[model samples]
Target: MGQHLTIVDHPLVKHKLTLMRKVDTSTASFRQLLREISLLLAYEVTRDLELTSVTIQTPLQPMEAPILEGKKLALVSILRAGNGLLDGILELIPAARVGFVGMYRDPETLQPVEYYSKLPNLLEERMTIVVDPMLATGNSSVAAIDLVKKKGAKNIIFLCLLAAPEGVARMKEAHPDVPIVTAALDECLNDHGYIVPGLGDAGDRIFGTK
Candidate 1:
């Protein structure tokens, strides 16, 4: 919880990521790889979830069983592409509550503009994990996090597939307390705010849109 940033460097994660980066990777393959990689990333992010023991009965025996403690987790996706990561994480943590936040960039100012938001109630109590595939300029990410915080989400973690140095720095300055978990921390952002060496537009690659 205290770590500011975590770059998941597992071999499997790296392998799938390499495949995802290929321009020739078809939409179906890209989507499948995203789901596979997301499962691995979700494992790393949720590795430290608090657990408590509860008494349970097993065929002619009684014993204590470990179960997740405290309020159930809430998975909030930063719209469009975030849904790709959300679907895989949901497979791993099926019982988690889900929400969505939609935001688009302002072409003139290179800023984020929120268009939609729907969050769970009593967010202050539940641990919230926000998902997005690419953290480029981080304007939208920061805006999305701000919205969740306004709704009372105190404990929050951001999960993304790739991040630019600019985005990471921006997130650190804005929300130093929130931890960021990503697969790769790429080079600086390009002139148009795209992550250099990034797998192009995540939403486009994910949905086969240009």
Candidate 2:
């Protein structure tokens, strides 16, 4: 973990991200594309998962097979937008434990305010992945990770659809042990804290809200 960031640059991820960035893309289409892209990014996030061999019965004979090591993963979605990534990743890793952290940005200060948090027990023993669609200002992400850490989560990974340089730097400064995975790292954050050239207001787009 050490302030790492992985940009998933696969063709499929790039293509879908392009469509998702379009303002003309329908809400339904945006949601679907997010699901699709999440599936692909899931590959990168879980790429380094440890595997151990165990004795197993094959079609013809007994053999050793590789299986995931250690306890099941814990996936903590950072509220509404994170759900889009969580759903798709869960489909890939059905045995994962699920949690949710709800936080809202303070209008005046542009800070994070935690509203709800319910996480699984034994967080320290599991690999936790925190999902949020946009890492624009990173205030929410940093706050959300802080809450997760307080629950004893040790191995943590932050997953998102898009990110800004400011957000990435902020995350590095706050939590260097948590790695970040995203489809694209955008240029910078705007005055309103939106990622430039990003799929605007991921929560609004995903939920069809203003």
Worst 10 residues of 1 by lDDT: 104-113
Return the clash pairs for model 1, or none: none
Per-residue lDDT over 38-144 for candidate 2, one digit per residue giving the tens place of the 0 to 100 score: 99988889988889999999889999999999999999999988999999999899999999999999878889999999998899999999999999899999999
lDDT, residue 85, model 1: 98
lDDT of 2: 0.93
* Per-residue lDDT of candidate 1, residues 1-210 (tens digit): 578999999999999999999989999999999999999999999988999999999998999999999988999999899999999999999999999999888877889988899998889999899999999999999999999999999989999999998999999999998899999999888888888898999999989899
Q: Could you tell me the TM-score of candidate 2?
A: 0.98
For model 2, give the 10-residue run with minimal summed lDDT.
1-10
